[model samples]
Target: MKKLIINADDFGYSAGVNYGIIEAHKEGVLTSTTMMANMPGFEQALNLHEQYPDLGIGIHLALTTGKPVLSNLKTIIDVDGNFRNQAYYKGSFIIDEQEIYDEWKAQIEKILATGIKPTHVDTHHHANLFGDFNAIYLKLADEYHLPVRNNFTNTDSNRRTTDGFIYTMETVIQSSETLEKVFEEYNSVELMCHPAFIDKFLLNHSSYTYPRTEELELLTHPRIKTLFSNHKTIELTTFESI
Candidate 1:
């Protein structure tokens, strides 16, 4: 069977984001989402989770967009103390691997403390796959026994992951014929998405702003829901099942 895990990233980024994700799961093909433990809408996301217990939640380990869950990070943060943006990681910035490990561990523990069993793990801006960060990402997954979203960089036979990972935003807005080709291509795939209602917080913080609303519309569209239900070979699944 061809399995597809449509996972909305940044579940706890803001109220708009939280609501968008919930709507996607409730009315569309979205089967799972990864929550940002340190994001502003974290508490709201937790409360929403209480109402929708079937939506599989995972830790969206972050280091680029928000403040660190653990304080006094020596390398990951900038002079102003907020975590540095994605550009810093792309450049020759030096970071302490141990700090990344400790901070991410705290993020996982924080979500666990809320009594939400995460289905798997992934990173914001794919930061965890950078240099030594991938090792720490895998380390935490092994310790917690959680499957990870495959970036094709951190492959291990023992680690649980979908056979393929698709990050293209264009595919999401394409026709149903295009989407069907995706399911036919991979035995199991993890499609990364960020669907939101486009609030002030999201508008101010994220560079990828308006596209979120576009994604939300496409995700919850009646046509997309029908595609999932009509396709016998395609199975909408969660990371927990992988």
Candidate 2:
């Protein structure tokens, strides 16, 4: 049976994002989300998490788009304190390995401090996938003993989702037939999605804004529900499940 992990990212970026992620998990087929420890709406996200205990939570190991959880991170952050990365900003940047490690540790420790055990672990802008950061991240995951989303394993050299079968909102909205083909072809797949209500923060901080709403609508559609209806046929799962 194929296992599909539908994970919504950026749970604590803002109030609007928190609302969308919570709404998706509670009412839609969304089974999991990755929480940002250093984001603006982190507290609100944690509070909502208490309400939906079934939604699998994971640490969104952040090194981008905001200030570091640890103070005085000179190497990783710019003069303004924003990490050299943004939500939609994707490229290579020089990193101080030690500083980034400490920052991620702080991020994960912040989550554990709340007594909310994460279901798994992932990253922001996939910062962990580059340079010596991958080694640092994997070491942290092992140390924390948390299952990582897509670690060093590589079946496809592209995206880091399960077997590299990550799908986009454009594909989902434009053609369900394409998705069906994908669903039939893969035994395991991790579909990453971002759903949010855009505010000034998202608009200014991310190159991706309005499309987030579109993603939210597509994932919550009733027709999409029918696809994962039979448990015996396909396992709708999270990293915590298996």
Best candidate according to TM-score: 1
Q: Give the distance in Å from residue 137's predicted Cα in candidate 1 to where it truly belongs.
A: 0.6
Please tell me which predicted candidate would have the highest lDDT against the true structure: 1
- Cα lDDT of candidate 2 equals 0.78
Stretch of 10 with least lDDT, candidate 1: 169-178
Query: Could you tell me which 10 consecutive residues in candidate 2 have the lowest summed lDDT?
Result: 156-165
> What does the lDDT read for residue 66 in candidate 1?
86
User: Residue 1 in model 1: shift from native, Å?
Assistant: 2.5
Instruction: Summarize candidate 1's per-residue lDDT along 51-93 as a digit string, tens digits.
Output: 9998889999999988989996989988887888888877687
Clashes of each: 0, 0
What candidate 1 gets wrong by more than 4 Å, as runs, is 169-176
Candidate 2 residue runs with Cα over 4 Å from true position? 86-94, 151-165, 169-180, 183-185, 230-232
